[model samples]
Target: IVIGSGDLAAGIADQLRAHPDIGYDVVGIVPETPDPEEGAVSLGEVEDLPRLVREHRVSDILFVGAGHPDRVLGTLLVKLADAPVTIRVLTDLESITLSQGVAEEFLNLPMLRFERRNLVHLRPWLKRVADFLAAAALLVVTFPVQAVLIVAGLLARPALAWEERHDYRGYPHRIPLFHDPGTGWRGALFRALPPLRYLPSLWPILTGALSFVGPYPEEPDENRAMEDWNLILTRLKPGVLDVTSIADHPWVPFRDPAGLNMYYLQHWSIGLDLQIVLKESLRVWDKEEGESRHG
Candidate 1:
């Protein structure tokens, strides 16, 4: 069942056509707009939902784009939670995704999560601890290579420019600060490397503006999109590496990995942090053609 004849609805249909294992029978497209483009089977506007539901036999409904998902979904939950056909929201909420229904049998989650107040307080401290550790470790592991890169950067006389990559999008990628202006690119490369990426982040750790492994601190303009990853970072530090970032994209568990600076918030933990780091190092960093397995 597909909703909204917009790109999201079309995109989901595309993905479903690509992955048959998804086990969904996508028969119709529902668009609020009067005229849907070519090749689309429009089920009419979302406001006439009862007719749409009846005509499409949409027992297990998925809201593709109903505006405020939280509010709109709440209404659907009240009306349809008791329906025998299981409903699911799309996973890739970036634009549109097939919302998978939470299995009823597994609804009882056992993990205890961090409270909002405690999570807020823990954020600053978690990064500081992670920063010190990451810096010290990277200094040891990459010292010789870093020295060569530093010397090459000094000799290269590379051009350094500070440009606003995206003004409307608040994620400002500034010219990375460097003592020797020529070495900015090298610095950028070094920072992109694992563990070393956290070195520059240490400064922020000192200032208390970030945590070691929390969600990527929202850029000033990112509050709109922050809702997507907020749950993942609620109790975790936004670290040098995101918890979800792994190599070969191999099987990153829904849980937090161990040792990459996680808090007790949101059923996340240090163990989960470490697992992510290990996956990053062994599977992600090890080879180019790695496949990530997700649960």
Candidate 2:
């Protein structure tokens, strides 16, 4: 079964029809929008997928479509979860292609074998425990610095700034930081020390709103048009420190932010999380040391 009425689906249908020796049938196309290609068997709308699947006895499903790809793919996956069918998805991201398992090219068309694996589901308890303990310890150790920064921020700018940022599931939460009120040297002091600005974020980590290591948070507006693979990363809790930002590898500089986050999600383990935390701690120490020498 093919899901989509776009040119891609039409082209695939044409190819399969032309080469019957390939030993597979084109089956039918399920169009999300109206008006599938002329004379194509329309398998009702996307909402009727379950009925169509049962009626057609679909052994395999080929998904090809555009527009809000994440939502489209997610919806299809949920519908076919228990349907005993081999799933293949066409996507532009090579990371997704590799992560989904065995990737293959058919007639120069790249497709990923869709097998869902939930990283969080693997060891949720262990991850939560690590997050809680690490966040608490860091907060306790940074108390003195936080105190100094609070005073410095007040002197520079009487009002602190709280900005709303979206978490992994697109839930909005406020994060507190120092605002530069243009008080010259005092404002510069607040800006120079990142520890001061990020101290309040620890509260979110403690409260389970954020994680110690995961994909970094981006503004909701900025991520509105993110691709399906990138959108999947948002399902993970936002972290204060991302592996991509502190991995200390030469290849780290060349990787796209979304690709790096996806890599973390795909290869996530408690041990990997510990490594990220250790690397981040060293990075912070180096930054503070440099600041002290300059100050």
TM-score of each: 0.41, 0.43
- Which RMSD values do the candidates have, in order? 10.5, 14.8
Q: State the C-alpha lDDT per candidate.
A: 0.45, 0.64
- Itemize residue pairs with steric clashes in candidate 2: none
Give the top-scoring candidate (TM-score): 2
Could you give candidate 2's per-residue lDDT for residues 19-40 as a string of tens digits?
Answer: 6776668777877566645335
Candidate 2 has a TM-score of: 0.43
In TM-score terms, candidate 1 sits at 0.41
Backbone collisions counted per model: 35, 0
Runs in model 2 deviating more than 4 A are 1-122, 152-159, 169-171, 182-186, 216-235, 241-261, 270-295
